[model samples]
Target chain A: MTRVETQDRRQQAPRRSLTRRLWRAAPPGLRQPLGLVAALVAAAWLVICLIGPVIAPHDPLAQELPRFTPPGEIAFLGTDELGRDLLSRILAGARVTIGLSLLLVCLSMLIGSVLGLLAGFFGRWVDETIMRFTDLVLAFPTVILAMVTAAALGASLFNAVLAALVVSWPPYARVVRSIVLGLRGNDFVFSGRLLGFSAARSIRVDILPNTLGPTLVLASLDIGTAALLLSGLSFLGLGAKPPTPEWGSMVSAAVSHFDKWWLGVFPGLAILTVVMSFNFIGDALRDALDPGVERR
Target chain B: MSGRAPVIAARDLEVTYPGHPPVHAVRGVSFELFRGEVVGLVGESGCGKSTIAKVLTGLVRPAAGEVEYHGRPVRPLGVGRRPLAQTGIQMVFQDPGSSLNPRRPVGAQIQDGLDLAAKRARRSGRRSGAGPVGEPPADPANVRRVIGQPADAAVSPTAARLLPAGSPGRWLERVGLEAADQSRYPRSFSGGQRQRIATARALAAEPDVLIGDEPISALDASTQAKVAYLMSRLALSQGAVLLFISHDLSVVRLIADRLLVMWAGRIVESGPTEAVWSNPGHPYTKVLLGAIPAPDGAGRLPLVPPSAAAFDAPPVIHAP
Candidate 1:
């Protein structure tokens, strides 16, 4: 058979097999209810974030009503201190907050995984150099590092994401490096070398696949932390400047008007919902991905 | 058999693991492997039998000396750009479970070897200006000579094209696995089946020299016999030189043409398998042979003392 046919056959086989395995491995009883609820909530949140701007009734920034208006017919969640729709602002903010967090997580995972694979595969000097650098980055608390990076780069939505990416990648690298260190000595890797695979090819084929599951679990868990950090940075005036309608920025705007519960409550709930959903999903993924865990 | 050129030859190979004291794994070990010949390297655990196999297959680099393929010194661990020499050596590891990537299907793992073989074929074909057919290329340069004319003047282009379409399935079948079983992951298979898959993978490379580092040690007696029989048959069919490393004398005796008895990192005895079985020379070889329990439940065999003299002195008996 030609290469294309072989690839086609393999592709066809895996899709069916994967679905079957996943169906068979689905969580049962209380775990199932917990996992299903978490998955649904996370999925719902992502959908809302994706379509929030399209469906929002009022212009998030429009000052159409009197400032600090209570929930009524025109605006379901009431108006903010600026007389802007709290509901619309929260809806608009979802896109920026969630999207930036996702991007940061992906970028960090990519950078971290590659460096870790290299360090783990080629031990001794290569391992030491990369790990020492990772240790340096990890020495500082994550938020402090993000704060310093944001401060250095100048605060904005993009700069906050960049800072988070810079600060978060070291953990992924450390996790992947440890995983690779354990797997490099496996007989499959040795066989790969004996089969004339180059070091890079062996790492890509043998090491990378094994590292992905754990890294994915890490990525999911970190997304919540990243979202929280990004929101915290914006609350501190280091991210998504005024009139941008970011969740954290909205909460920051509501702080002085302590009696205007609508301004803080809705946006706070949005952040809480998103972060909790991610944590749930991450927990489920950790259990699912572990081979030692009994799926049934 | 006597006149046949050795496919691979090691000269005074030494491998040491760097540490506080440094492990002297294999010391001054030398052996020659010929086409279609199965040479068993047997010793008790930690005697460096596996290390010798690793050295021969280029998995472990020797601290001193070199491994020559067709009279040329190839890199000990497939580290260099010499694709021709690299493709010629392949190894099956001892642990079947760990020898396969858990995430990948067994078939895909087998295809890795096939892919390497195909690449090697394409490269050699392009270099020789012959389209991977007819007689093998005659250029001494193409033979990857280290210092002299290669005993085998040409590498068989057939070796490269050995894995055609559906060849992994064919190899799996040859190793007593189902064709459809290739689609399954390594974790899905039993230890014996996984070993068979690993064997299939090694055979798929169509290597000139195939090394089995305690390949059957992990299997039960029945599976061991079956896999050993399959390996010997496959090696003969492919005309590949087989380096069967094991501490199990019975298994080696069943498969090997010649035997190299290792004792504390040195080959203490070397001879035809039957001859050595009949009249073992070297104290270590005698001890190894005596250690094999008699099948008829007879009285205990006499215990041979570990020879300290062999450690300090050169081998006293060299078999012809």
Candidate 2:
């Protein structure tokens, strides 16, 4: 009987490994085509942000082209009124526009989720203090609050990011807090407490892992919004002062010469593509993380 | 059971949930559990069986009562800071599906009990002379041992019989679970298998008082008997006091050494299992026993008639 069981196990082993190997070797794109395309687009922007200066065909700041050149001029996407290449300027702007938005979103998410977890888990006074502060911050429109803070701190990119960070965190705190409150009364958490786990230990070991998927989906969704808000800040002259290649400031510069058209359209298209890609990635992430939702 | 102090004793327990009309969940209920015996507390829904379990485990504080472990009163001391004595009273909740954390591997959940046990042993200085804390003791039983074995070691000959393969497999195999499946999540297993995992976790603590609040009712008819038998047998072998709470009298009778029947937040009857089964003293006990359908298909069991008002009222308290 033992020999027969061993023979049966040996027969099953190779078949399992072969299927797993085949699955692993298949490209991720083949399984979820839309997600793959979105990921590729997002990855291309990140690569461009890193190597923008090296790959630009012309010096972004150097005035070497005819003034207000339209598309198909010596400059690929034509030139700004000051005659700088629009393609090169857009390329260099990707770093400040995309990079700063990602950094601010990450910072806000970290701050918000921690406060939320503590408030939901500890309750009573801890809940009261954190939630009241969150409520106060959330009372104002986020843009108005961010604009005021950025203006107060002087119209610069750093201050704009800091301003956005201040307003962005309250939503995350609210989301994480609600999730933790729901799980607080779950049986597994009670079981953890029965086994002599401290509140901190229970939050870390039992509750935190369950909350991660939802929080990640929320974070992905927020990336596009963060970029838009930062661009809005720059457009208002509260971020990315001139001489710095920022897409929002570049578009703002185009507004004076509305007839020039190419100046506004190209930079607008760059923002659109990046934002759309992130939104798609967020949709894919939500589908992947939520077990209740069917994958399309 | 005589001449030895009870492992756990409850005195005049009362629980009331405040509202427009206060709900008195458990009123003037008391019981004592001796080590190495399965004492079944049988009742229908909302008869305070779960409340009693909660009061004993210190999840809910009783309005007026004290829970004594080995004759000394132990109060609830918040989470993670539970007194070493109170840590020995572990509970297995009814819904096996929710009792185990869905995200965690079953092995880590089992290991939680083991790690806490080791920590308790270290703090109490019980292992000072045993050897290094990490080293396995020379006696294989000690390596797998729970705290404070009952005076009669020979009482659980069935402990050896239950797990013949030896101690290395630990608590998982003893409860009829695969030790190899320890790393898998709770969603991977069926309801019966999850119940087995829950039982394994409760027993891994080597608890002195193991409370099963409707532990097997959620399982299918076939798996119910197997899980119930496994739970009682394993708890008894560890020299633990098994408080098997269930609505199903049939499953309870098969494993319990003694029986306590509850009605309207009070126990109406108490005695040895066979005595209560054969000649129940209380009308409520009689009604409960009669409610169990006999498989011979002789006749349908009578439902509780409106005329049976005596069965709904609380019976006179009897000290056991």
Q: Which ten residues in a row have the lowest lDDT in candidate 1 chain A?
A: A21-30
Residue B177, model 2: Cα distance from true site in angstroms: 2.6
Worst 10 residues of 2 chain B by lDDT: B128-137
Interface RMSD of each: 2.0, 1.6
Residue B296, candidate 2: how far off, in angstroms? 3.4
Off by more than 4 A, model 1 = A1-30, A70-74, B78-82, B126-166, B294-320
Candidate 2, superposed: residue stretches over 4 Å from native: A1-36, A294-296, B77-80, B127-169, B298-302, B305-308, B311-320
Q: What is the TM-score of each candidate against the true structure?
A: 0.86, 0.86
Candidate 1, residue A3: how far the Cα is off, in Å: 40
Model 1 chain B — which ten-residue stretch has the worst lDDT? B127-136
Report how far off residue A91 is in candidate 2 (Å).
Answer: 2.3
